[model samples]
Target chain A: MVTRSFPGRYDSLAQIGEFIRGITDKAGLNNFAAYTVEMAVDEACSNIIEHAYGAEDQGPITCTCKVNTKGLTIILEDRGRPFDPELVSEPDVTGELEDRPSHGLGLFFIRQWMDEVEFEFESGNGNRLTLYKKRTTASTKSTRQK
Target chain B: MEITHTQYKHCDLVKVKGRIDSYTAPQLAETFNKITDDGRFKIALEMSELDFMSSAGLRALINTQKVCKRYNRGELVLVAIPGNIHAALDLAGFIPLFKIFDDVLSAVGNF
Candidate 1:
């Protein structure tokens, strides 16, 4: 498992993305799988900064990723308000555009891309979100288009 | 993210390059507002060089599209979308929300 902590700021989003890219690269995930993981993590962390922490630079977000023969698991921890994305009900994704609610889309995408998503909260600490993506055709395939 | 504008006879073309996450989505929304504030409703977004876009970015586009499509005044169309973003749009069920095109000229001509 590789773990990294980031300042809960919007600017750190880019760095977080780079970090995930590196991890996915090292795991030899296919392009689509890597992109899925990247997008899921980005959405999760961004939601954390906006909702959990309620603002930028207000807390710390630690991300942990573990890749094994079967799948990849990611756990994100934030020392902020407990805004558990797992509690956000699934939105009406395929409904009419006018009928769709805007708030839950990020979480929806996260759920769609990941095989599993769960949340755990500590009493005096903070919120933890875990996501898993099963490897369908991976283990040694690089994401490169060569 | 960088936003550049080009005015056409029928619509305004907004070229966006770079990631559109929560941090930068507001800027994109503001850019659309500027166009609408100028009394232009029809807009074409050239996203050939776009690297990334999250749900926040989708929210910006959908909100603007709703405004432009209100009362049949105009609509927002997408042009030259990247593959990954196309997949994102597909997964979000956003493909049916706006008219997408292969190029800006076709999108501009649709107005």
Candidate 2:
């Protein structure tokens, strides 16, 4: 498991993606899976920065990734204001695009991209978003080619 | 992040360059609102030069798509979408919302 802390702000969110990339690259993860990991991880971190902290730059956002032969498990923990991503309802994108709202789609996208996404919240403090992605044969082959 | 706009006969082409994360997604959102709020639709977003996009950026696009579609007078075509944006769109199942094109000319021409 590798762990790193980043400032919970928009500018600092980029580091979340880079950190996931660094770990996945060293773990010999496949390109597509690596990209998926990066994207899902980024979505989690962005949520912390934007929603959890409300773009506050003073707080810390920590990410941990545990890698095994078959897959990667990532956990993002933040000590910002308490929020539950799982509770946010998915947007009604089925209707006219013009009538859609701008927000409430981040967690939906995160769930869609990651193989599995779960959430846990601590009372009056913060929350944790856990994500998992299993490595595939094609991903292994792509990693081997690298 | 940098954005350049070019107007054609039928639509406007807005080219975005750089990362669109939580920090910059608002810029994109503001631009979209300013341009399309007046109900002038048929805008083509040329995102080939865009290198990165986080969930905030996706939300901005989704919001803009909704607004543009509501006037029901025009369409928002995502033109020359970069591989990264394409991946994001695919993950969000938003690839079907826009009429995608390979190049700026084709996208604008289709309008």
After superposition, which runs of candidate 1 have C-alpha atoms over 4 Å from their true positions?
A137-146
lDDT (10s digit) by residue, model 2, range A1-146? 88888877777766677788898887677676677677777777777877778867758888888989878888889887777665798876565555555677677777876778888888765888888887774254332110
Instruction: Write down the DockQ of candidate 1.
Output: 0.44
The ten-residue window of minimal lDDT in model 1 chain A covers A137-146
* Position A114, candidate 2: lDDT: 73
Largest lDDT belongs to which candidate? 1
Q: Score chain A of model 1 by TM-score against the reference chain A.
A: 0.87
Instruction: List CA RMSD, all candidates.
Output: 2.9, 3.7
Minimal lDDT window, size 10, model 2 chain A:
A137-146
> What's the DockQ of model 2?
0.39
Summarize candidate 1's per-residue lDDT along A4-109 as a digit string, tens digits.
9999998888889899989888777778788888899999999899888998989899999998978888999998887855577887768876786777888888
Tens digits of per-residue lDDT, candidate 1, B1-111, equal 899999988899999998898888989999999999888999999999988898999999888888898888998999988887888888888888989899877888888
lDDT of 2 by residue, B4-111 (tens): 877666777889997788778889888888788655777899887877777788788777777677747677788777664676676566777888888888888888
- Please state the CAPRI-style docking class of candidate 2: acceptable
Instruction: Go through the candidates in order and give each one's DockQ.
Output: 0.44, 0.39
